[model samples]
Target: MSTNERLRRRIPQQDRSRAMVERIIAAGHTVLLENGYEGASTNRIARTAGISPGSVYQYFPDKDAIVAEVVDRWTDALHARISCVFAEALDGPADQLSVRVVMGELLDALGENPRLLRVLIEELPRSPDSRLAAFERRMDDLLTVWLRFHLRGHDAPPVGAIAWMLVRTVENVAISYVLDRPPVERDIVADELTAMVTAYLRDISLP
Candidate 1:
């Protein structure tokens, strides 16, 4: 069966069942945080959720499925927060101030859950069809639109390429700041990133 089909098969349809599934996902997050991916088990997740192992199996086929659901929810939330930042940027000129706002918001959002962020970046296995990859693609499209509007009539690299670079650069640096616990202050990191991105955009916009 297709991946989507497998996912659909795992989702509970009834209200009570759905709540149980959510509980399991929450427990999965806790266990994954406490135990790391290799150490997390369905029994541990079930214990954390205050449910039996069979209950966990009722909602999810295996430990990996529960972890996927947890990651999916986390990515969806992070995607929404970052997407809103970009959406707001579309209304204003993509100036240095706008770039600063975007960078600041990104750092804040990613820093909100540093432990989970560390687990995601350092522990989880990534695949092409993973939720994280999907989140990146969505951000790329949003950024491409924003860049195209601001770079109109300017000699620049392909907007898609610029958007891809910007997304990856900002994501990596922000994740690093959150996970690495660098001695530099948060605002300083945001300021540097903002300056770097703003300068790059300006250079590209030049004829």
Candidate 2:
């Protein structure tokens, strides 16, 4: 019997829907990590998920949809983690050192899953879909709100633009670290980026 057949029999019909969906997402992560975006196919993902191709269809309209959902979940998690980092460090001295501490913590949290980060930065653009843009904007908007709230007392640059720039800069740095010929030291990159950003923001936010 094939893997799909075995999985169908092993999973009860009542639990199949959610189980299959999770399986598809998990398989997507695996396939994208292993084979990359262009190489990851619906058939391969279904095989990895141990579900029939038809089962994958029942959950996701197509591969793009599956990838999009995965990216969305990833972005949400990243935003939440960054928010936590800022929260813990927000009340400390509002200086470059404090920013460095917070951003370094954030990068460490992010480094746990380099593959997913690579897929998100490199593949999402190739997908050429509007939903990805919306997702990116939503994350930026959330970060913007956090900056505005935390810097309420300071004369800061435009919150929305600052947030957007920070998010894109981080994304670029992360992609470079992930895809460089020789992987760059994430710690060094994060520190330099934090320092540069802190300096720029300080210029505009001086009391």
In terms of TM-score, the best-performing candidate is 1
- Candidate 2, superposed: residue stretches over 4 Å from native: 1-13, 91-93, 126-159, 181-184
Least well predicted 10-residue stretch by lDDT in candidate 2: 3-12
Tens digit of per-residue lDDT, candidate 2, span 103-193? 6766675677778777766665644334445645765776676678767787655889887888778766655665563556767887788
- What TM-score does model 1 achieve against the real structure? 0.92
- Best of the candidates, lDDT: 1
lDDT of 1 by residue, 76-154 (tens): 9988988898788767876888888889999998999888888888888888988889989998998898788878887
Per-model TM-score, in order, reads 0.92, 0.70
Residue 19 lDDT (model 2): 74
Clashes of 1: 0
**lDDT of the candidates, in the order given:** 0.86, 0.70
- Residue pair clashes in candidate 1: none
